[model samples]
Target: MPETIFRNWTSDLSRDWGKKPIQIDHSLSQNELFSKDALAELIERYPIEHYSLMRTSSRGEEKKIWRRGEVGGLSGHEVMAQIASGGLWLQLRELKLVDKRYHDLLQSIYGEVEQRVPGFDSFNHEMGVLISSPNAKAHYHADLPGQALWQIMGRKRVYIYPAEEPYLPQEELEKIALTGLESALRYDPEFDRHALVLDLEPGQMLTWELNAPHRVENHDELSVSMTTEHWTEEIRREQMLTVANGILRKHFGVSPKRRSTEGAGFWAKAVLQAGWRRSPWYKREQRKMMPVDFRLAPGTSTTIVDIPAYVV
Candidate 1:
C-alpha cells in the first residue's frame, strides 16, 4: 500500500472520524485487492456460504437471491462475468475473517485511522468488498456499527439521512441488531428532501454518523467498493443494550423506558440477554434462512432462472 492512498484526508482529522459524513477524494487504490482476473478468481474461490449475489431492479425494490452455481459449471468467473456484463451486486462479505490479505488490510487501515484520530481504536472490525452492476441500487439501510464506504472503481450516489426516528425508530434498530439480519429499513422517497446526497467516484470514500440511515445507487458503469464496519467500546456496549432491550420488549412484552447502557435497567436487561440467548430456541431462531427464489442466468445481464433451475 503506497502512501498515495488517502491523499485526500483532511487536516481536521479529529473532528471527522465518524460523527458525520465526509467524502475523502483520492483515498484508495482501485487495485488494492488485485487485477480483474484475480478478482474473478477471488470471487470464484470465495466460500459459497460467505458470499451473497443478488438480482434486483434499478431502484433495488424487487430482489431475488443469486448463487454462484447458477452460472454454469464455473461458479467463480461465471459469477464475475455475470456481474460485469449484467445487473447484480455481489457482496463478498466478512473478508477479514476469511482471507489474510483482507485481514491485514483492515488492520492497516485502522492503523492509519488511529493516527488521524486520537483515542479512536475500533474492535471486532468487519470488512467487505462489493461489486455491483450499472444502475444497481442498495435500498435504504443502516448498520449496527461505525461504517464507511470506500470506492475503488466507477461511480455511485449515496444518500445519507438524518439518524432519527421515522427515518430509524429505536425499536427497529434493536430488532435489526438482535435478529442478525441485514439492517434494511423502510424507505420513503419523501425523505430524500432531507438527505445529504454525495456522488462517489474512484479514489473517494464516505463515512457517516454511526447508525445513520442511508442507501446507494451505482452509475451506468460497473462499480467496486469496500465497506468497513467496526464497534468501539461504546458501540459494543450499545449492541448489548439493543439486544437486552429487545428481549425486554419482545419476550416480556414490556416497553423499556431506559435506553442508556449505564443504569440498573441496563444491568437487568444484560442479565436477561445472557439467560435468554442461552436457550436452544434462540439458536434455532438465528438459523432460519430466507428463501432464495432465483439466480442470474449464465452469460447475460438481465436474465434470471427459477430456483428449480439448479440442483445446488
Candidate 2:
C-alpha cells in the first residue's frame, strides 16, 4: 500500500471537496487488496445477503431491464469472465462490514479526508465494490447520503448533474428518502446537455455535491470500482427534512415550504420524522430485496439458467 491513498492532493482539492464535481488521482489501483486475484477471492466468500448480481439492458437499448441473479457454482474468476462477456454487473455491498481489511481501508480514507478538509466531520460510513461488464450503464439516480466513486481498474464515463430542480426534483428526492430507493429518480436525455461528463480511469476517484444526480457507462472492458457513502451533520438534517416533507405531502395533503436546517421549523420537522420512523408505516415503506430469478450456468461462462424466483 502507498503511504497515502490520494496521490495528487492539493489545497484546491480540499477547498472544493464536496461543493462541486471533482476528480483526483489515487493509489488504490496499485494496492494488492484491489488486485483481480484478491477481489475474486473476496467474491467467492462473500455473503449472499451482502451482494447484488444484476443483469441489465445493453447500451443504447430503449427498454430498461434490471434483474437479479446469483453466482451459483461458478468460481470468482468465472463470474468475472461472464461479466466480461457483457450485460451484467455485481455489487459487493457494505464491504466495511464484511471484511476487516476493507473496513480499515474505509476508515483510513475518511480519516485522511477529515485531516485535509477543515471542520468536515462525517460518520455512518459505508464502502462497496462494483464489478461491471463493458458497455454496461448505471441509470441516472441520486443518493441520500454523501457519495464518492473510486476506480481501481478499467475506465468509465461518468455524467454528473446539479442536485436541484428537473434533474432532482424535491418530490423525487423525498420519495427516495421515504422508500430507500435510489434508482427511482426520473431522467431525461436532454439533461445530459447540462451535465459535467468526465472519463474516470484506473487510479482515479470522483466526488460531487451532495445528492447530485449522476449516471455512468463503462468502457470496452471489465471495470472494477469502489463506492463509499457517508453522512455529515448537515446531510443528516437535510435527510430528516426530506422525510418530514415527504410525510406531510404524501399523507397530510400539506405542502412543506420550509427547507431551512437550523430553526424552530426544522426542529419540528425533525421531531415529526423521528416519530414517523418508529411507526409501522416506516417499516412497510422500506425497500425489499429483489428475488433471485436466475443463476449462472454450471459450465458455460456467460450462460444464465432461469429458476423459480425466491428472496434470499
Candidate 3:
C-alpha cells in the first residue's frame, strides 16, 4: 500500500531540495519501469476538457481571450494556442487524484532517491500532485522560487532557457504572478539558445534554477508526473510585496511606503531587490540549484529524492 497522505505531506518535498548539485544514478537503477498498459490506464481514466473565452484588462479595453483548457476540460490544446496568441495568466491544478498503482510507483521511487540527499522546508503552504496530462505549458516565464519536476510515469520533452542576459522585465512578471497562477504569459523574444533539451522517462527527474525559462511537451501517448515547487522566504516575501504593490497601484492607485522601502514590509522588498541586483545571490543561488536525475529498474526496487524549497 502507499504511504498515508498527510496535509503536510509536502514537508518531505522541501527538505534538501536545493542544497547541492543533483545526481540520481547512485540512488536508482537506470531503466524505465511503467508498462504500456499502465500508461493507457492513465490516459483513459482522466476526464479531459477545454476552455471557454476569458476577458482580461488590457490597457483600457476589455480584451477577449482564452487559455489552455483546464485539466478535465476539453480542447486543452486550443486553449494553449489561444493563450500563446493573446497571452493569459494560468494556474492548472489536478482534478482527478492519482491511483494506487501510480502512487505505489512514486513511493518506491522516492524511497531510493531520499536515502542519499535530505530535504529542506521553505515553510510555504503550496504543494501539488501529478495530473494525467503533462502537456501543460507554463509559457516562457520565470519563477520566483525553484521547481523540481519528477517523471513518475510516461515521457516528456523539456526545453530550458537560462537566467540572466535578455531577462524578462518586472512589470510583465508581476502581471502573471499577480494573476494567481492563472493563465498568463511573460515570454522574452530576445532569449538566445535552448540551454537544455531533455527526454524525461519514468523514474527520471529534472530541476532548474528559479526564474529559469522553460517549457515542456508531452511526447508519449499520455503523461503523469509530480512537480513540487519551492521558494525561499526571501523570494516569497518579495513576491508578496510585489502583489501588495500591485494592489496599491491598481486598486487605490497609490504607492505606499516607497519614501524609502528599505526597512518596510515583512521580508522587505527593497532589501531583496538591492541584494538580488548587485550581490552575487542570483549566481550563487543558481549554483546551489541542481538538476535531479533519476532512473529505475523494471522490477520492484525503489527510488527517492529531496523535493527542495522554492520561493513561490
Candidate 4:
C-alpha cells in the first residue's frame, strides 16, 4: 500500500528502541491524506476536541501565538491560503481514531516492530497530523509515550536533546503530563549545542527515546508531518511511575530520587495514581478553544475577517 512503513530496521533497534534517537526511511509522505486540498478539508471537518489552530507571529525570536481559532466549514484552498502566507499551524491529533488509513499504517508499523525488534509488543498506539506554515516551529517539548515523527511533506530541521537532567527536568515533565499547557519546555540556547540535529525530508521518519526533548523548524514551504505514539507494557509501567512520582512531587512537595518501574515501591505508587485519577478531585486536562477571532478571505493570505462571535 505504501511500499513499507518502516523501510529499514537493524539489530541495534532492539536495544536502542526507546533509549536513543533514530531516523529511518518511510513512504507515508506520498499518501493522499497529505495532499494540500485533502488536508484542508479534513481539518475543517475535524472535531474541536481533536484539532487546534493557532495564529503565530512571523517575525519574533520568541514563538508568540497571537490567537487561536475553532474551525467551521473553511474550504481546503482557504486554509492553505492562510498558511501559505506563513502565520499559522494546525494540529489534527488522534487521527488514527478518525481515519482508517492512519489506523492501518500504525498497525503495520507495530507488526514490523514486533517481527524485528526483540521484546517489543506495543499495546496502544495514537497518531496525529501536523500542518504548519512555512518557517513555523514546534518549540522544545517532550511526550509521555514512546514517539516517532514521520515526515509526510516539505522539509524541516529538527533538534533532539537528551531525556535527562537539564534538557528534561523532572518537575517540567510532571507539569506537562498533568496540566493543560502545550507540550512545550523552557528552552535555553546552551542546550542546542548537545542536540542531535537532523534535516528531515519527505519519506523520512525519526524517533527518539521515551520522553526525549525535541523541537522543529519548518523550511520555506507548506509542511505536513505525522506523529505516532505507542506504548509497550514496559513503557506503560514507566508512565505509571511518572504519574506516581508527579503525585509525590506536587502533593507531598518531595523531589523523588529514584526512577524505578517495578517492585513493591512501584506498585504502591501505581495504585496511588490509579485511585487518584479515578477520584473526583482530579480534573481532566482539556483546553478551552480560543474564540474564532479571524477568517481568511478566499484566494488571499493576508486578508482576515474579525468575527463577532465564535464560528460554528
Task: Give me the candidate number with maximum TM-score.
Answer: 2
Write candidate 1's Cα lDDT for 110-138 as tens digits.
87788888889788888888988888888
lDDT per model vs. reference: 0.76, 0.93, 0.43, 0.79
Cα lDDT of candidate 3 equals 0.43
Query: What would the per-residue lDDT of candidate 2 be over residues 185-286, giving only the tens digit for each residue?
Result: 989999999999999999999999999999999999999999999999999999999999999999899988889999899999999999999999999999
Candidate that beats the other on TM-score, 2 or 4, i.e. the better one: 2
| Candidate 4: C-alpha lDDT | 0.79
Model 4 residue pairs with clashes = none
> How many backbone clashes can be found in candidate 3?
48
- Residue 44: error of model 3 in Å? 6.8
- lDDT ranking of the models: 2, 4, 1, 3
lDDT of 4 by residue, 166-251 (tens): 99998888777666464647889899999999999999988898888899999998888988888888888887787778788988
State the weakest 10-residue window (summed lDDT) of model 2. Answer: 296-305
Clashes of each: 3, 0, 48, 0
Q: Which of 1 and 4 is the better model by TM-score?
A: 4
